[model samples]
Target chain A: MTSEQDPRPRAVIVACTDGPLLVRGEIDLISASGEAIPRTRKTVALCRCGVSTIKPFCDGSHKLVGFRTDPVPPADRKRDEGIVTGEEAPPDAERSGA
Target chain B: MVVCAGSQGVDDAPVRAHCVGMNAFDWARRSGGPPEILFDARGPLSAHLLDVLQRPVPESGEMLAALLPATEIALSQSVDVLRDDDIQLALFILYGLHYGQVLPADEDWEWNPSLITARLALEREFEKRLRSCVPMPALPEVDSDAVAGALFDLTAPDPGPSLSRYAAKRATPGQLLEFLVQRSIYTLKEADPHSWAIPRLTGRAKAAMVEIQADEYGGGLPERMHSTIFAGTMRHVGLDDRYGAYVDNVPALTLTSLNMMTMFGLNRRLRGAVAGHLAAFEMTSSIPNRLYGNGFRRLGYDTNVTWYFDEHVEADAVHEQIAGRDLAGSLAEDEPQLLSDIMFGASACLTIDGWVADDMLDAWSKGLSSLRVPLAVQSFATA
Candidate 1:
């Protein structure tokens, strides 16, 4: 287990079904061209390739380029939205007049 | 909650069974989910900020101790302060502390006087520079009714590429990604910047802001939360979705967009700007979102990929009216003195966003990458 005080920053990449990678944790995140940035935060997003107007973050650029290594159904995507909304609902059982 | 406006289902249900509400505009599809930080030795500026925030009276302390050098430089030059990427980045971090997106300097630092003094010092200049360029509308006699009208007048976007229109037609895959990256500064946190104004509002104005915000917040759904949906979009596209993940790539102008909103929302004196910003934001959202959806679909994306834009097409149609008339209008009616600031704030959103859009299109048009530097690929690369 790494302690939060560990001076060394290890970046983790979590994969989702739709767009860019979500990045968290301590990282220098220099550009591939090598510009040392001035920010020191616990989390930051970096662009996967040379795109992203928002730069270091993913803005669903893969879709624009047809970058498809992971192909998931649009249904799964809908369910994901449901999960996000459903969490706020007390319970599914409560919604229907059982 | 689900007012069926689009169509009815088999049981004569609303055709759009999907809530597909305002929360959709908040989502940005990224690729890699997000990373976790193991540990770190704090930077001097971030560390000092933490110390001050933890203090008993952060509202009156040395929040800018580590940043004095940069501050000195900002105080020295005119062209540098607004254009200097470093100064703007630093200022962005300092403000980020208060917004709760970045880690706190010290809990007490949230309101520390000296730290605020430092922030105020930077903001005084920042605001002056912003005001010089912001194009404030002429104020009518201060009254709630007059103020609202001014806000509506300001939100009418002047002719430009209509980035959304451009996105619908011309955006390449790379350009779309770049667009998302630029949007991350605000979308990752979604409605929070404007929520800062919630406490400052009263009666009808407060109610309107809350009504609009509630939809922005997915009406309490976590999955539906715009930020989370944006995170999903990030994962879909193979980018990082974590909050504050892309601070490095944003240029000063990009940071200024978010900073402007925070500046308006955070200050009680600028409540009108906050109202005006929201009004303008709502007014401008709809058609462009449709164009964005078309752009994604043109590239062969399924509804999942384009749903966020699709949702905005419907939601912001309703939101803009509420924001323009009820929120901004009512606030102006309640407090006419804020009219000019309200109009200025709306125009600021349009103006700053125009700069960001123009910068992106300019890069793409020139066959160039819009990011500060190209992302590294260990094996293969494109751009």
Candidate 2:
């Protein structure tokens, strides 16, 4: 069967805000040296914070260190900085380069 | 309502005796031993309930009429229902019928309407007391991320007296055994109470719950099941691995901890609370489990004994994330009305569990046994 026609659901990785990235479905977890990381659970949480006692997987140390993440979407963040909307750009006459 | 032929225990003795006589005959024909009494009844309510459950249900009038009044008297007499031995044990027995094998009685008694009525009466009061005493946190906006954030904040590590810390640093070997016995009330059954919410949920929330529960059930490997792993830990530590083996020894608050979860899970309206409870439960687990394992290791116990705690350290880390965001957060987003209940459930879990911990720490601090009846004297030989 074609990839699209495959009956099984594809893997999903969710970036949980202020928390680890939750991975679901069947996916190979590999190390920097290209060796497989032994994952025991079907769904696993990969550490987003660098301080986890168990690296590559969260041991919930994020809360202890007060980790955080920007909740805004990247595109929206850029827009907010006036990259797209130009809401805070210099006055029209001052836009000499344009 | 399957009514007994008589209203009073004294009046019903002859009929009960006849029923017990027949049951004994059938039991003897089928087995080498008499039916095992599962637990010691704490008071008249539990005592009477246990007596009636052992025999066949009568074909006639009100057998459990005494249960309602007994429950009423117990509730009225007890100052705090949560800590009251009789009320908690009676509640535990009634809830046990649903869990199965908890009471060695006629299976038909599981659905006997009178028992159900008495259980409902006790549950009504139990829930009322929990609500009255267990402080609820402020509700977050009806959004998944917001809900998750609120729960994480609520369960954030606090500087209170921690039982796990005591287990790590100061608990005696005997105290360690008490710890295992007290926890065995729920940990041996593990993820079962929360699984009741599976059919009650939908979409993202349902899938999230199943994912966590699947892991809790040991990902289809029986030996790896959390409960099985817990049992192995119990056995390695020289305690009986059978469920309810230590029921008679634990205080009411220990039973109350499990009873709270079952109550929330079994009631459809409290599905949100169960989800939130699971989230908070997972959130608080990873760190303490690490400490618990350390305590056991400090006492020279090996991987076989520490494996349960070590396993939870990783599993609950994964589970807390899923429980917080995918399960509780998504549920709040989907069904906004349950948001408060979800918060209530999470807060209640922390409150009751904290009390249980305090109970143990209080006893241990005083150089006393945490259990209602201390375990029989035995050597805890470290490997």
lDDT of 2 at B376: 72
lDDT for A75 (candidate 2): 65
TM-score of 2: 0.86
The model with the greatest lDDT is: 2
TM-score of each: 0.65, 0.86
Evaluate every candidate with DockQ and list the scores: 0.01, 0.12
The regions of model 2 sitting more than 4 angstroms off are A6-9, A71-98, B1-31, B59-62
Candidate 1: DockQ?
A: 0.01
Give the per-residue lDDT digits (tens) of candidate 2, residues B255-358.
99889999999989999999999998988888777778878999999999999988887899888888888899999999989898899999888888888887
**Tens digit of lDDT per residue, candidate 1, span A1-98?**
55787766576654422233444445666768899764322223344533444455443233233333355478765643433211111110000000
User: Which residue ranges in model 1 land beyond 4 Å of their true spot?
Assistant: A1-98, B1-66, B78-80, B103-108, B140-150, B377-383
CAPRI docking class of candidate 1: incorrect
Interface RMSD of each: 18.1, 20.5
